[model samples]
Target: MKKKIFLVSTAAALFLVACGINSGISSEQIGLRKASLENENKVVLADINYSAAQPGEASVYDRSYENAPPLIPHSTEDLLPITKDNNSCLSCHDKAIATDVGATPIPPTHYYDFRHNKSMGDVISDTRFNCTQCHVPQSDAKPIVGNTFKADFTNKDLLKKSNLIDVINEGVK
Candidate 1:
């Protein structure tokens, strides 16, 4: 029994040593970037060019996936820093005024509170006030990693619009 254990241990050690000697990977080859992990100076990001078109002039892009936050089609240069006191986005995107200005209205989900599960009645829920948390302006920068994902919308209307409120509890027990 002792001889069998000794031979098994010896074979396992030899196999591990052989693997280390034959297939050792360097630090540079460990990551997808194929660059030295210690060097930040060597890493260069692709140039990001956001939309320069003003609101109502830029074209809306199809949703990346079902219930995905729609990207800001126009430049947000002058409408940033959404504070509690001032949210420039509401000037155009508020439900009451959005249609008049040809801007997409803040969805019904924004008016309903998920935590308390009640309607706020004409007020944007505090949780949904920060539009940029989920939504971002579109950029022309190339992706660092390749993706082959294609969004499969159940219906054509879901391609551009979100029905998160309608389907939020679809599978929940």
Candidate 2:
């Protein structure tokens, strides 16, 4: 038993030593850019410039992708801290009032309780009540690192060929 343990320990040590501590590769060879915060004494934070609420034709903003959370096209200056008794968003976004206010009503899915397997009547389900969890107001702040991401359906021809609603509801009965 002692000989088996000794041989196992020796083999493990030899394997680790053979792998060596360093690959001897420079940072530049792997194309690693310097971190944005490396030179900053204080933590570098982006200066968020909140966009003002735009009415009428100016209110529209293209969604990042089909079924992606639509960016809040208007300002959320003093309209936050959504509470049990006081949700400021419901004043305009509630299904009953949205059409009158010319605001988009919260989707039917928001009222559907997936866990309960039933449609919640009139009110936004508890799970979906906090709108900010999935939605964010757009800001004119530049990212510390550049984004190179491209949406899969950016091409107009490709987008036209696919029915987004059908794709989104593919598995639902």
Candidate 3:
């Protein structure tokens, strides 16, 4: 009985060794980039080309999904680096000025404090002040990985706009 068990274990080990040897994967072919795992110099990144349209001139992009943050369609070269003292986006995108400037208003969710569950009045919540954290400028670069996922929205309006404040607490007790 002992001899039979030893033979079976030895055969299994040898089979596993043979399978590993037959596996054609190498260290360079391991990841999606197809570059050497140990060397960073050989990896070449795809170029990112962002839209050069000025604010309020670029066409708006549809939301990627329900309540997904809207992408910045225009060049943000002048409006970036949102410091506490300076947020150029508010000049047009603030709730008060957006409509007048033909820009999408900053959603009500940006003004409400979720942690304390209270309105923050006209001021944007500290957590939501940094636009780039959730929103990014649209780019004309090819995707690293192919995406087959499609977004389905119950309301057609949600495809172009966010209703996050209205839907945030829907299922929550």
Candidate 4:
């Protein structure tokens, strides 16, 4: 009887310790809660899902046109993507060279003049330098779930990418 009591006590203590360990851990640490995902009290799913993709799970942009956004179609050579330090979108489009490529130069509207600091007076700066901050990949990615889409413009040549409002409405449906 004493042995059984000792064994039972040990099991109960182990169980309590396990529970205590988790209780002491912050919700973020345990992933049950995240301040990062809290957008006005709603848990944002985009920031939470990071999968260790399977081997070869991500193609080398090898998807077909029906399954992909139009691939860059040409080499963005010497281009400085907005993530210049890490981006590749502007290496070819920066006004310095777009004329050579017969492509329009990046617009004046695209630049942010950060002349606030006296030292930076009259200098246009790349604010929010991360290209993804304002421009998203033209991923033409398929919907994760089934989507029945009909083009608003019946002409094949006129089918363009959806704007923000269009994408949001698609999500709602």
Candidate 5:
């Protein structure tokens, strides 16, 4: 009897793993909601302090295309990515649906034609398969570790005052 019970439990575990339809992050990581810790992390719903109260325009996770990547606001482990024929972003971004979900939908950028792609002969997955590759959520929460980033913008005047421009004008004097 114990052997049968273990077999059934193992099968169920395999099935869930095969299905990517789960929150990609843990509750403790995102800081809200409830979940079980058995093979997954958990959080108490009461622990939630803030929420996406009202849905607005579809969010663009990566604010600066040249800088950091965006993070997901909600769970996306369960979401299916876009492929050659399917773009699932429209599923939630249509104002009719996104407003109800309390999260923004995909922005018009998704509609833009990205020249980036893989050659069919190369057998690569469509470049869009990994949404996280480009877009990322900006979290207000504290950093997971000490930040190393220092401001280069703040030092702009340092160069302007150095008379360094005149030196360069001499061309290696």
Candidate 6:
């Protein structure tokens, strides 16, 4: 029984070594590709070229599809940490003052409390209070990965058939 056990252990050890599993170095040391940002020289901590957007100067980006959340077209440097009582965004984005302030009005859908029986209300719903949750401020930073995504509007055939707004209003039926 002792000889049989020794033989089995020796065979296992031999098999591992034969399969090159005993290599002292990691798989990364054996020609594994490094991250896209990693380089042999010139270590970059962060994107140095990125700058904070100026107030009311941010360029509006086109939406990818119908009902897509519009990107914030201005700086939101001090307008954050939305609380129960305070929301700086509401000063200009609220329906009553948005047109006068030249800021886009918050969508009517934002007033509906979807979680609480989808009831409509006068004020922005609790679920939609934080504007930044769905809307992101545009930046000059380039994406790490190439995006091949194309919107439906780009297709000439679709445009010829009917306007995008008409199709969206008709629903998927």
Best by lDDT: 1
| C-alpha RMSD between model 2 and the true structure | 5.9
Off by over 4 Å in 2: 1-41, 54-58, 153-173
Off by over 4 Å in 3: 1-22
TM-score of each: 0.79, 0.65, 0.82, 0.30, 0.30, 0.62
Model 6, C-alpha of 55: deviation from truth (Å): 4.3
Ranking by lDDT: 1, 3, 2, 6, 5, 4
- Pitting candidate 1 against candidate 2, the one with the higher TM-score is 1
Give each model's clash number: 0, 0, 0, 9, 7, 0
Candidate 5: where is the Cα deviation over 4 Å? 1-69, 80-89, 94-96, 114-129, 136-145, 150-173
Candidate 6 lDDT score at position 127: 75
Which consecutive 10 residues in model 4 have the weakest lDDT in total? Answer: 59-68
Clashing pairs in 4: 78-91, 79-91, 79-92, 80-90, 80-91, 81-87, 81-88, 81-89, 83-87
Error of 6 at 69 (Å): 0.7
For candidate 2, list the clashing residue pairs, or say none. none
lDDT of 3 by residue, 99-149 (tens): 998999999999999889899999989998888998899789887789999
| Native-to-model Cα distance after best TM-score fit, residue 49 in candidate 3, in Å | 0.9
Expressed as tens digits, the lDDT of each residue in 36-83 for candidate 6 is 333445334445342266645555566655456776667777887777
For residues 1-173, what per-residue lDDT tens digits would candidate 2 score against the true structure? Answer: 99999999999998887676466644434433333333435343556788776533336566666567777878786888888888888888898988897887777777778788788989689998899888888788766568887676645554223334335567879
Give the per-residue Cα lDDT of candidate 4 at 50.
24
By TM-score, highest first, what's the ranking? 3, 1, 2, 6, 4, 5
Candidate 3's displacement at residue 109, Å, is: 0.9
Higher-ranked by TM-score: 5 or 6:
6
What C-alpha lDDT, on a 0 to 100 scale, does residue 99 get in candidate 4?
A: 75
Off by over 4 Å in 1: 1-35
Task: Quickly count the clashes in candidate 2.
Answer: 0
Q: CA lDDT of 103 in candidate 5? A: 48
User: lDDT scores for all predictions?
Assistant: 0.91, 0.71, 0.90, 0.44, 0.46, 0.66
